[model samples]
Target: MNRDIAIMVDLQKLWDRKVEFEDGISHHEKSIAFWEKKISDIRKDVSVLKENLTQAELEIRLKEKKVYELEEKLGKLQKRRDVIKTEKELAALENEIKAVETEKDEIETVVIEEMESAAGIKKSIEKKENELAEAEPKMHEDIAYLRSKIENYAKEVRELISQFNAGLSKLSPEIKSRFEKTIKSKEGKAIAPLEGETCGVCHTSIPVHIVLEASSGIKAMNCTNCGRFIYKKENV
Candidate 1:
């Protein structure tokens, strides 16, 4: 099998670059979406408040209609009192008028309270809508900026891949294939440099005989601990 340290290094570098670009793009998109969701929530709140105000206004109108009906009935009762022939009939009519007036007074109080509530709700709705309107433009700008950054990052990642491929082509075909297999299995990390007779990739001591074999470069060697191909660097 081909075991080329240079090819492995390039592949590892490319993998790191790809991961960095992917993570950056993901973070940027998430931030953009988060802001948009906040804006949407604000808009929804405004709509709910508007609906509440409308309902309150409708309730007040109904109450006012009831008050008008009460006034008309009270007027008719008063007229009857002037022309009534029986004392018992007049007393009943007066009692009815008093009861109607009391009910109307209670309803009017409720109507006033509802009017105030409706005004407050309308104000709240307007405030939230204005906030959302101001925020929407900022959100759009943020999303556009993120998209631009992602585009640039993708270009960088592509350039890195091209460089990595060029580095691999310099290796012997057999070595290239072997390194590709090992690196793929180990997640783009292969051909680790030996440190003080220890496998740097696996952090395990290499046998004296194996260390000598790696130095000679007659055959490929791997770390017994992690099974990654080993390369010996000349200097520290």
Candidate 2:
């Protein structure tokens, strides 16, 4: 085969391999992104937990203050019991004090329930924080590892591209330009090996004259149907 045609074959193979290597790089990039998103979500969840804890604490403080106020009110009502001058007045004072006591008891119950809720929330926060402390570092390590793999794949692609460009450099400018254009138009495939008297890719019958020239390796020709360069390899 002509040296230029041989180089084209080699360049074609290089281009295909380059695509595969780039795909590897792409895979790693996607994995890195996934890890990053997962970490972000975890942090967001932790932040939301913190906000809820703050709100719960504030609520508990408010309820406790209400209970204190009710107790003070009950104490003053009890002191009024000592000053009662009649049986009817004494009975009315006792009923009023009982109402105050009931209200205070209900408020205290809510305060205890809220304190329990706050405790549970605190425990959840602690658990999640511990998980984050451990998982965040591991996630970062995984992302770093994936990034390194991408770097390696990128380096390999760069080298393969250099080799492919070297093969193109060996061709005449016209042939090189033609190959570049065709490869782009054909999605990275610009040449096909001849299949007997037909185009290997499109299977279009080659004119006898064109086939003879191609088989002789005297010149290069394109298949009219598929528009790819046709080359014949020697029988090995």
Which stretches in model 2 have alpha-carbon errors above 4 Å? 86-95, 182-186, 193-226, 230-236
Where is model 1 more than 4 Å wrong at Cα? 1-3, 165-236
Taken over the whole model, the C-alpha lDDT of each candidate is 0.80, 0.85
Looking at model 2, the pairs that clash are none
Best by lDDT: 2
Query: What local lDDT score does residue 115 receive in model 2, on the 0 to 100 scale?
Result: 83
Q: Per-residue CA lDDT of candidate 1, range 1-236, in tens? A: 23465456556767677767878988888998899889989988988898888889889999999999999998888888889989899888888989999999999999989988998998898899889889989888988998899899888878877777787788778677776676667356767778878987778998989888876655767777777777676544
Worst 10 residues of 1 by lDDT: 1-10
| Model 2 RMSD, rounded to 1 decimal | 3.5
Query: Using Cα atoms with residue i matched to residue i, what is each candidate's TM-score against the true structure?
Result: 0.78, 0.79
Top of the candidates by TM-score = 2
Per residue, candidate 2 scores C-alpha lDDT tens digits across 1-236 of: 78778888888889889888988988888888888887788788879888988998898888888888988988898999889899999999999989988988898888888888888878888887888888888988898888888888899999998998788889877688989888767367888788888988788898988888888876778887888888897773
> Model 1, 161: alpha-carbon shift in Å?
3.2
| Cand. 2 TM to true fold | 0.79
lDDT, model 1: 0.80
